[model samples]
Target: MPTPLAETLTQLRIGNQKFLIDFYQRSRHLFARWAQRKHQLPPDKAHGLLQDTLLDFYDHVADGRITRMPEDLRAYLYGMAQERIAAHVPAHQPLPAAEASRRQRLLAQFNQLSTDCQQVLTYFYFRGYHFEKMGGKMGFPNATVARRQKSVCLRKLYDLVRGGYEPITGEVV
Candidate 1:
């Protein structure tokens, strides 16, 4: 009773490993090339974007957000990819003076963080690593540990930026 796309979506939702594997194999290279050529993203970034897009697609199907079969699955995926790319890549315009100063202050405070905190934040934010990957790289026992560490580090950074502590004196500033 179901169309091919509906069946595919059902398989994806039910965690059909073979179907997922085939889908990834069929889509990955084409999507990567499209991302690189259309968006001018580097190969590594494009690949990372592809991973994120696929995960998002899977989540949508699993969560019933994408219940109906799209007219064209590839186009649907590409649309999601474009949205992801736009969200992550900032515009090239220069910042306002005040914003620039704020960013400078943030960077200074960022530099004052512990090396472990800096690395955790950098890997999670700049590199787009999930907590599991971050845990392996940072030698945390599990993703929960990595996630907790990131939360703690992010809170520390926020406190520093909010002037909760004096950078030099460790006193409230």
Candidate 2:
């Protein structure tokens, strides 16, 4: 007889919603513990990986990739979690002296940007705020406005970092 997971996998392949929910519920805890304890992905990134791997697994099964259900479904989920983390995580390294100097200079310029620019950039890039929420917080009319603001601020920051200053006055141009 097919295992519960094997039967569920057959239904999951055909885009069965209940099976997908069952899969998610069954795998969620293992995905969390393994992604953090074994892989050391930050909590937020790990959470994101959980959702992404779920979708990826569904996509793979939907596209005829998982022809036969694996003997161990939890192990399969853990493997997928590890693969997803590996694909996204950057290798850790100490900054070179030249790059450190550039970073310091960039930080100084970033600090000199308008307070609005600082808030917008910090919210989006550093704090990971959604554009919609950031727009509401920053009192913008909508996310589109916040997105445009982010683009303009990012360009100004890049320019400032790349030496876009007055030749004699040393003021930002």
Candidate 3:
């Protein structure tokens, strides 16, 4: 379903992913120059052209090259292809009404947590740090303490999210 030029752009992007990240320092310039020359257009125009060309390239070659590619290169090529596609396509804007409401409620519950709990949760969840690593950074001896603290914090978060509960009868109104 893709044009031939699109297929070639995909191949070039796929090939370029090899070698070190530092290696690309010079190659990026080369790519820019090549792109300019090939398209024979001004800067912005060339960029737009490059994006479209890359998309066409990716549409056909995606399955063919993906399995055989090296890990780093595969990641890089996939990223480039995806970016090219994304450039022309309008991005999805904002959460839906229900999602927005849910997110707001979740944020309010998170804000109600104690400062220490908030820090712990942010480091572990949002920052993607492991429990052991967070424990080391936070001065806990091991993961167990960090895990325990996370559990207590999560329980408090649950209570907040559930809204006001009965103190004695423990039933939702």
Candidate whose lDDT is highest: 1
55-143: candidate 1 lDDT, tens digit per residue: 77776775578776678777887898899777874423344789558646776787777778877876776455899999999999999
In angstroms, the error of model 3 at 28 is 22
Q: Which residue pairs of candidate 3 clash?
A: 6-56, 6-57
Error of 3 at 123 (Å): 1.5
Which pairs clash in model 2?
none
Candidate with maximal TM-score: 1
Give per-residue CA lDDT, model 2, range 1-173, as digits (tens).
53465446545543455765766777666666766788776766665676666666776765567766677766786787777556764433334789557646765677667778877876776445899998998999999999998998888888887788522222222
lDDT of 3 by residue, 1-173 (tens): 53343333333333332222333443445455654665444555444444444434333343344323344543464356356545755423344799658756666666667767776776665445788997897778899888887887777778877884322122111
lDDT of 1 at 137: 94
Q: By TM-score, highest first, what's the ranking?
A: 1, 3, 2
What's the lDDT for candidate 3?
A: 0.53
Q: Higher-lDDT candidate among 1 and 3?
A: 1
lDDT of each: 0.71, 0.67, 0.53
